[model samples]
Target: MSEAVLPMSATPVATSRAPTDWNGEAMRRRIALRYAAERRFRLLGLCAVLISAGFLAFLLISMGANGARGFMSTQIKLPVDFPRSPIMIDPAMLSTNPDQVLANANLPQVIESSAQAAFGKDGDDYISSGAVAALRKAIIADPGILTRKVTITVPASAGIDLAAKSDGSEADEAAVVKLEQARALSTGFNGGFLTSSDGTDPTVVGIWGALKGSLLTMAITLALSFPIGVFAALYLEEYAPRNRWTDIIEVSINNLAAVPSIIFGLLGLAIFLNMMHLPRSAPLVGGMTLALMTMPVIVIAGRNAIKAVPPSIRDAALGIGASPIQVVFHHVLPLALPGILTGTIIGMARALGETAPLLMIGMRAFVASPPGGITDPATVLPVQIFLWSDEVGKGFIEKTSAAIIVLLIFLLTMNSIAIYLRNKFEKKW
Candidate 1:
């Protein structure tokens, strides 16, 4: 029955001829249409790039807008007249009406009152009343304000702070008084931003204490981190044996880098401040904490830099009668210098911006004194910024912005230097 059904097997039909293009342009046009029809991927890629660029520009613009005023300052101009016999001769006499006496005194009056005063009668017209207050503060700090009758034209609020502004204009809407206090502050040039201190009143606080603390912290971090990092890197990359213990140690170091920075803060609090009895809020303690956090990173980067150098270079140096240390230092270190330096600057930038660890170690303290040394109580920039941001005042808004700007500038400068160092001296093998 199957053989009978198979008798109907049909012959295969011939396929039709395929179409051919006669014109080259037409063929190209057809291919172009095909590609265009499949172009969704390219369009998506372009959209992604444009969106990312737009987001970046937006961030930069926002930071600039908020932080720009930090570069400018408000000033209060006051006329002063230093008058002779201005000394009250008693602290009570000066204390009874300090502001009143200051208000009544003009620049010429104050200057003329000082034995060291040197100014024409019109000098009072050119000085800031706010500046005179600062001088009075200095006098109060010293035991001399009671007997000193300096008719100082103190700086007033709303006067441009030159250090805080690039353009030095306080008349702009951004710097204008938004609150009664600011309006009150608008009386003359407070000594730019540098003379200010951290306080609940943004009008009265400055970042100087914070600035100095950052410097001291970074200095100690550099001093402690660099040598130790380099030494550890050299041992691990050049001399250490690769065993289970070594592997474990390497893993631990890597894990250390991943640890939350706040953990390091707790560690600093326990080990440095509590256990070791180190002073709280000291840069030394902060630096130690930060360096502990940074060490793992530095070691890793250093090893990578060393590893990037070819073994052949080492062999050549040894063949030329160089000792192991000389070969590594003279040849490998030079080649690795750029990467090492880049890592260092990056670490410094990280440390500079660190807040959590510093917070634990007492750097979160409201330190008003300029840092005396490594062991002195101090407030780093981020801590200062944090403190200022929490302050309740219309002026703190700008002060916070200003502090952020300063922090960003330092970070940017450090990064720029890193880039410069990397590019300027890097050599190809």
Candidate 2:
């Protein structure tokens, strides 16, 4: 009991430490540094987006500027006294075969005479060669014009057209000024650009032929590729046994997707052209070639889309006594359709813009008319643009830009339709 007398002096105590200052300079600096890093990252990302947008804007603006002129054409008005002119044609013949009758009517001579009477002897030089066709169309539309004096407006020559629209040589500028002073020269929408077909004259060339060819080619490509690609994907993903052969096929497909597009062109040339004896420069051949190139892409996309369908869905279907085929076709396929369509859009878009494959198959030929069928000789928009771009004429520059604009519109329209279909089929699990 006496030992407890020294215990109070020997007692140990716990120490108290100061709390961390979250708002202090060091701590605040660290938080600020993290926020600053995030802000820098965001700024860099925004800058990248802006730069990309700027480049796109520049391209679009430049194209629009150059292409807008292509949609317009310059015209010169001339008064023709057809009754007094030495034009030989029976107006009655127009109702049966107007083009032939007009062709034989020596309308070019009448136009030359009218131009000389209206402006000068050199006035014929300012008129486009397309004027004869224009006059023929007008005469056929109004046979009464042949019996009376009337003024007819016709497209000007390429040089005169350039002067009226943008820049030109001194002689062309002078011609333009003279025509303007007479109130004879004017600019109007180029209706021919949409209605006519390719020709030696740029003013008369139209995109309809190439556009139709592209449509036909793409139709064939889609018809051949989509079903086959989907089936291949379904077999590989759902039915194929896990073996070396399947693995080799999968690897081959992946490699094919990465192969150069020109290689596909060569393959098409060798097989479709040399072996199959398919029509050269036909949409059918072009489409078949593009289909070969596009199938692997569709298959890869389809397999991934099918794989993303949950295993539980399959389990549930099986639990309900649903057959394997029924479960895949009714449930899995519907669920995977949106993603598959997305892949189709990508593949089709690539095919639409491709030239080498079609070119190799001889679709680079100068198609004068729209294809009546897939087997008809034709050229797609890309090949047409390529051909136009290679021309030495200044008029083709505008035509090339215009064709590009048309191609872009076509691509956008096609993608929009595909996206719409995808969204329509999209379902949440």
Candidate 3:
């Protein structure tokens, strides 16, 4: 009875509402704000990319402008009356024992005399110190040339080279002018920069030795780190039980990845050089040292890649009578390979550019010749660049920049190869 007597204000009432106004001012404002935020974010990203690109362009342009000359040689042609010159070597001796013949012939004196005869008393000063070696090489190449009058084109001295390319001292400028007037001074591609090895004279110094050493060292590093890192990742992710020991190992690996690169250098120095007695500046030791530093990064990347593989994939493989090992190797590994290669590229690139670790391991030595093998004394490109940058000679400055260009090219080549491999292995499913 009391419920029936309830007032209208006390009674429950049903209400109806209009459809949502998607085009309403509030909704439009919210949508506009989102679009504006997205636009702002895109603008920020574009600006970031442009700034990075600008820096990279500046680096390339500056290096090219400075180091282009490094890849060029200034040559001065000089007439040598070999028959009248004081070269005492028998033409026959050049073929049988050229080194001995050239050494005994006193090529420096021969070159100096030839230069002075062609130009004047200061002609010798305009010739590169490397002229002796150049002349010796020419003699060995053609023993008959030793018996006749010939014009030899040899590299100009460093000062004259600078004067021809950019700037030089007053004497060098005068020499350049005179040589130019004689049509003896000409700038040409420096094939020797790629073919020869390190030396005191910048005209003859080359990057081949350091480049070869870097390749050999990287070979060792890739050989050691890739397989080891992959297997380690597999074990840690798939097989290792959840235990205190596994946790500790996981933490240690993470920490190792963050350790200062110099720490790895010290470790290599102590173990490879002091205790194990490996060759101090050998690519073998350097490669092994770099392997230690690169492995952790590879392992971390590999683990994440492996973990990303769908569990259903493993279950399906197991359901089809595939063993666990087969599932991991045949299926999981293939799926993870692309990611693994990405990590490998990053690791290798970092190793390639590293100087502190190599320096600690004695790779800073002045390697005058390319190493015959990994165990032989060698220096990597970064160490070579570091050494060249420290030189007082103006020629070495361009050389340093040239070395940097080479290093960048090498890195790009390596990364390109790795990326190609990764793309080849990547799967859609």
- For candidate 3, report its TM-score: 0.92
Tens digit per residue, CA lDDT, model 3, 38-118 = 999999999999999999999999999888878998998978898888878877666787888788997788889999988
Instruction: Give the 10-residue window scoring lowest on summed lDDT in candidate 2.
Output: 6-15
Task: Give a tens-digit lDDT track for model 2, residues 78-190.
Answer: 89899989899987778898878887899899999999999898888889989988898788788989999999999999999998888988999998999999999889999
| Candidate 1 lDDT over residue span 1-429, tens digit each | 554466445753345876676678889999889898779778989999999999988877776776665544454322232223453334455567666554554523443333123323432322333445556655556545334343332343323333223343444333333322333223333344675556543445677888888888988888888888888888898889999988998899899988999999999999988899998899999999999988888888899999999999999999989999998888998898787887888788888999999988888887756887888889988988888777654456667787887787778877897788788778543
> TM-scores, in order shown?
0.70, 0.92, 0.92
Show where candidate 2 strays beyond 4 Å. 1-28, 427-429
Instruction: Please state the error at residue 168 of candidate 2 in Å.
Output: 0.8
By descending lDDT, how would the candidates be arranged? Answer: 3, 2, 1
- Residue 348, model 3: lDDT of 91
lDDT for every model?
0.69, 0.91, 0.91
RMSD of 2: 6.0
